[model samples]
Target chain A: MTRFASAQSIAHDIRSGKRSAASTMQAVLNTITQHDSAIHSVTHLFAQQAMQQAHAVDAMVARKEPLPPLAGVPFGVKDLFDIQGHVTTAGSIVLRNTPPAAQDAALVARLRTAGAIPVATLNMDEFAYGFATDNAHYGITRNPHDTQRMAGGSSGGSAAAVAAGFLPFTLGTDTNGSIRVPASLCGVWGLKPTLGRLPRAGAYPFSASLDVVGHFTGTLEDLRNIFYIMADTPAEPEPQDLRVACLGGWFAQNLSPALAAAISRVCAHLGLTGTTELPQTPTARAASFVITASEGGTLHLPRLRAAAEDYDPATRDRLLAGAMLPASTYVQAQRFRRWFREQVHAAFEQVDVLIAPSVMCEAPLLDNPTIMVGGKPASARANLGLYTQPLSLPGLPVLCLPLSNTGTLPLGLQLVAAPGREAALFSLARKLEQAGLAGRYPHNTQQAA
Target chain B: MTSPPFSDEVLVAARAQAMELALPPACVAGVIANTRVLQNYAALIRDFPLPDTCEPAGDYTP
Candidate 1:
């Protein structure tokens, strides 16, 4: 069987006599062990525990007990998510001596209940701080499509593992585009649910106000199904008629030629002729940055004070700067956020889903970590969230999906909906997937483990 | 935005002193560079006009 199977198909195989859960788990672990050398997506593997869980699934099947929807499906958690008994390093040495978690993170616990096995702890930016998963403690998570290129962070490892077909799905957290940017760069399906819609318990905190718990999947169906399970909500109907519009002005500025052309194709398919623009787009992005830095810096202030040397140099510097930001700056940014949120919320009155590029371009090369912004080179680490940061300001639900066959490494698009309207995002993503306009590019050719 | 309230080195030294957190010699340069980035962002939203009624978005005042 091809290792690039989706979670749905894996579950089907396990439920039927097509494959044993134990064998499926072994194949997944073996694939990572043999193929993850270059990608560095996995930090630790729960080999023994995963195998034991798999055998139990096989037993359940032999007994003819009803199988769970995701029975025997293997997935990975971003290192920051607590996986009971394992010390959640959050990709830093500072928490190395911290106690092991008493219980699974809320979402992890939910997946475990659904019979999904947590197979590994994935790599990420330390404490989920930077956009680049260039962790100081753990090595960088290289893009599966092009190893020399980046897998955007701080959720880089989670995205790369799915892109590599090492796991069918993986969990990630987004605060100012952690989930969207990497999923875009890695060419996978990702969802940033409405702020606080999903449980955040046991997941490591970054920015209290902006932080969100989400996941990345290889296919749109798995993305939708797993979300409902984690949300503990019944599946909502996908609306057939969606009021869709492409975002303009600030969102329209950057173009990588190919990305611009692809966007045009999707807009044309949707019969969209004009674009809707958000008010004061640049300032919105600035507000997102300010809020995230302030909250994240404040959250880690105690630890930073005690053990600043334990942090990744880049993360430490950013947190240090964030901690010292004037209280007025934080308050003013929040005030701006209120105004900006109202403006966007009003825009939703006319449009059901807004379309935008997830990243300005495909993943950047590791050697030259720069992206073209305003026709000038800009640091990828800082500017990768140009599109995503603004959206985060309003706590809206966004779905980032890879555009298929862009003739390069992977480029992605974002489908945004009003708060609590994740169903709308999925409906539009499904239509694009059917149109052959959005989906993951096949990576199984290189290492069809 | 161009006229920052304080010099980077001066502000860092003062903030460090007030918080009683030691700024390691090696970390100062990186911290200053990052602070400069934040200063530019702070400038962008610093003076934007907002209605007096606008409260901090998610900030709850009990």
Candidate 2:
């Protein structure tokens, strides 16, 4: 197995003339061609265009021109993001005949401008609805750690690609744990920045209010650097001596012994003595779900009416039900959302960051397709977002960090902060990484002897 | 959570007519099951007491 390099390391080598950009891009494409079959993470590869872009970066370097921060780094996007002249299928066949996108999505355009080449479009849950990336259109994306288990999707492909070491980073969206769940299961560093912190133009919509575009990377530094580049903002310095707390109540309930122990170790390392509770967490989670269903259903109602047969059976059924939701219910969900946001903001007054488990356990087996929720076997597709959904209600920044040395499949911990305080999350995650408690799960071939 | 406001028969009818959904007969059962789940979630948010002053999150100016 190839040892994957971070975006920072790749750019450093290219900029110093230690390696040519074309060679790096070719290697990435070759790796995807050779290895991606086992994981099924990539949906479409842009080999020719990516190679041309890599040559352009090399030309600039030869001419002694200033290089961008991400010069020649290869990245992938969830199929929902539009790349110029390419059809954005959004992991479904319904849009197969649609005209090619005239331009890149807003964030994609930003990454391109910074010299990161888009090499492929990754698979996702059809229409970004389910937690499992079991698209009827695109075959299910199996976890790279263990092919029989799920990758924990709608952004499963994005996480799996990074976990498989095929790309330095890949873009994904988090509406209701789409990014976090997959990142947790795949053991990659994923960031769902504060909602609205990154632009979303040209990306296919799921829930207008809940959708957040983010990315997954194998390194914490890469996650932070790429986030600032996409946001087009200068990095904010992380404040020292930040107060942190563990979340209890709903977040504390479900746990595999390994996951619970991991969280305890993190808390112990942070010296946290007690846990903070999010008020009305179950209700908050419920509100997030209702709002997502209503918005997503409303957005796709016209398409469902016209081409209902073109959708995945699972997605079609869910969207049909969401469309039938009473108007009063959607209104109430929004109302409750406003109230909940205020309560969450107030809770942030006492702690700068909060730590919680990203998923209850490791990825569930594809054959069983269930997770132990509240001590009962529940559908993984429905309940994988139990911890992530409530946090989504407030649109806070959450960094899903993979726990190291857990002696099992990947388990992730969410380092959450108030809106626009991603620096705090980065700060906390870095501390954990330095302490040998958090990092990417090494693939079998890359693990030390 | 409170009980769903509509009966199963009513919901099935509403899905076809009001929602303009034309799911196959086999698909109807799954749609109905998912609708029940959404309704349960909606019920949890519906009863939160809010003043008349509370406004929906529209275009967030901030």
Candidate 3:
């Protein structure tokens, strides 16, 4: 009944009769009651349903039936997914008129099939469009490490919920850096699995090409467990000796001294041999924006044209601008995607995994909007996902591993591998976590407001 | 950066071609202003001599 015991740990405890499923549920409910008023990470709770699910898991265990990996573990889902009996708002007021879903998303169903409980639907950016979960519609999802600073988004609430110890794990969607950025900001581990590795049916559509469902966890063991249950791959053993490539040039350039120092420390610890000099990422980032805006713009053109005022102003103009993009340009963006993936794939010849800073800087304050990283003024929304967007282009599996300490704001280091090689990435992450290179929300960030 | 020869009216015409929406005259300026970012990306692509035969990933229909 530990509030922050991982899903795997909770399941083990439940199976071993150390804690009843009801007791665990009570602990979670108590934690939410005690902490959520100021945190507000959860938007809506399915308390009764969660208890029902947990009890069913207990009954199964009592019958001596083999339990699923996530049996009796409570989970928080991002607001964007369609959970049966709840409205899938995706954090926008425009969707207020939509009716409750009749069924769960394919991913949600898969998790439930594995015996995980959906305790609540967490907050997110409107339409999954922003970097910070500072939605004009949902207010803002604050960082658990520092309430004043932003939790990277549009999966901010999911990351913050796990970091705040309300839930040991949560489900979120990453388009661009939604999962990784928040994982970095909140000092939690998160994974954006290979595209189509998990089915997307019933999740609200963003950009078809880039949208990926991901999960957040406090430790690499939880991250790997959740990923194994979620991804379309066989789990592997904990990492021993695997070659890691430190991405240089575009991925490493212009990072803040603190973040650069942190990445340098991680590399030094790993004894990483650098490889693969990527071309300038600014062009790749700009190209990614074009792809997202144009696709997102087209997808919402009807709503945009009729109820433009209903959209978040931050995303509104971008969608409208996307409506104006040339067909040839969209085609060009796709061509660039192919070329970029090929370029990245060619690098795998020399190394097993690639690593980079998840973001160029630490979480910025939500109230004070503009961000300055490495002496350059950056758009708080667009620039926060700088290290993440290009990888999203090729639909690679990337893990956001948090490296910051107790008193400091969180920063992340990203590990990526070949599309179906989630086991490799998880293996490496587990090793780093064991070495104390990555972990949960730091101790100082654990204070309740 | 010099503004592209393409004017706001032309870009709006292209947007209008893709969708049906009556825009206020003032709105055309905003779309074009925001689209300047795309032009910067275009400039970046222009720097690379992409092979004419290059194809995009996931471009083919399943």
Candidate 4:
């Protein structure tokens, strides 16, 4: 079925005329329409426009014109991304009256140029503020692996769309674990490329310094290929004989037994005997959180003044709190970020990549949304980024690869590298996939039944 | 490191007045709760041993 087909395979088939792009697009649309109710990943389907683009690809093929690498592949974007002539909601109603974007977000335009059709705008947390994609206006995006559980956000819909096989891949933005948290929980491959590596022209902003544009894909190959296309760079060869280390201390603590075993498996496979601790991890995480709140709050302060009532209560409250943060506090967080980045960069001197858990455990149940932190059940929304937020402070590239066959729900591991070192992350992810240690977690049909 | 004692009500009142925000009465309590969370996180950052020469990361120009 086209629903779960990799973007690379879809492009090959379309170019080979094994299937028309129109049929592929229609199949994805039909599948989304039929099955999306259970998961609520999609907020708006670009049916007519997507079909037209698919037809254009077919026409090009008919003329013997060269097809782009991702020709005829359907993908979705987090609702925050501007998709030309459509209003970017950024998962909030506060901007509902704002004019439609005049152009596609930079990455969306790049992907379109590479022949990938944007099929839908996916769900996300209001203003991309929450880790859980439980939107006050749009409703929650349920985990496909277990519908009763969460699909992590504000990129939750992007990850869920890929995890549920609705699209080959989807665009998302990460500022403090939006991409990694959801990708980990939903059991798909996601990448938060090095900060500023990919342009962010029209993606709605949150935490300017920390915001990174990236994507989620069903397959590692798709993730790698689309990443180059979006980054507008040729694939760099991954270095062989790369040094890797596991992150210990704060990262090693408060993990579920299943997650602990999964990390151990990865470590044993790589013959990693010792762990490298990032200096002041708890402070790193706290600094990241402070920066996010301050920046996001400041960005929305003007609107918050005018129409705070129009915002989601959860998001509005956080933004309000962020707006109230003293300037000294925001400044100090940025100072800490600079220091933390240097410390993290120094750690790379000893290792090419650092391995850490994407989340402490699997997706928390929606009915009882809590994750264990320090031997107590903590609010899932507040603590889900326990691991990811610290890493964000350094602006390093992190590939969130889903752990495979853990005999439990999906767990994800972060393969992290220094800035502009995504190749190493990709290389390590490929190795893990080959070793049967990392890959997409298949949707649980038994659980659904 | 201990943070200086701060009043949530005072901070919220000043923010509301400065931003000209019309926060609903219902939202104020939630905002205050979240403000406390921010305060705690801010304390952590404030306590980090950063030297004065360490500038905030600005536009990166290679």
lDDT of each structure? 0.92, 0.91, 0.80, 0.90
Chain A, candidate 4, TM-score of 0.98
Q: What is the lDDT, from 0 to 100, of the residue A446 in candidate 4? A: 25
Task: Give the i-RMS of model 1 in Å.
Answer: 2.9
**Per-residue lDDT of A345-428 in model 1, one digit per residue for the tens?**
899999999999999998999999999999999999999999999999889999999998788779989999999999999999
Tell me how each candidate scores on DockQ against the true complex: 0.61, 0.70, 0.45, 0.71
Interface RMSD of 3: 3.3
For candidate 4, write residues A163-202 as lDDT tens digits: 9988989999999999999999999999999999999999
Residue A285 miss distance in model 4 (angstroms) = 0.8
Residues A333-367 of candidate 2 have per-residue lDDT tens digits of 88888888888899899999999999999899999
Q: Using DockQ as the measure, which candidate wins?
A: 4
DockQ of 3: 0.45
lDDT of 3 at A245: 82
CA shift at A163, candidate 3, in angstroms? 0.5
Give the root-mean-square deviation of each candidate in angstroms: 1.7, 1.6, 2.8, 2.0
Which runs of model 4 end up more than 4 angstroms from their true locations?
A445-449, B1-6, B18-22, B60-62
Q: How does residue A134 of candidate 4 score in lDDT? A: 93
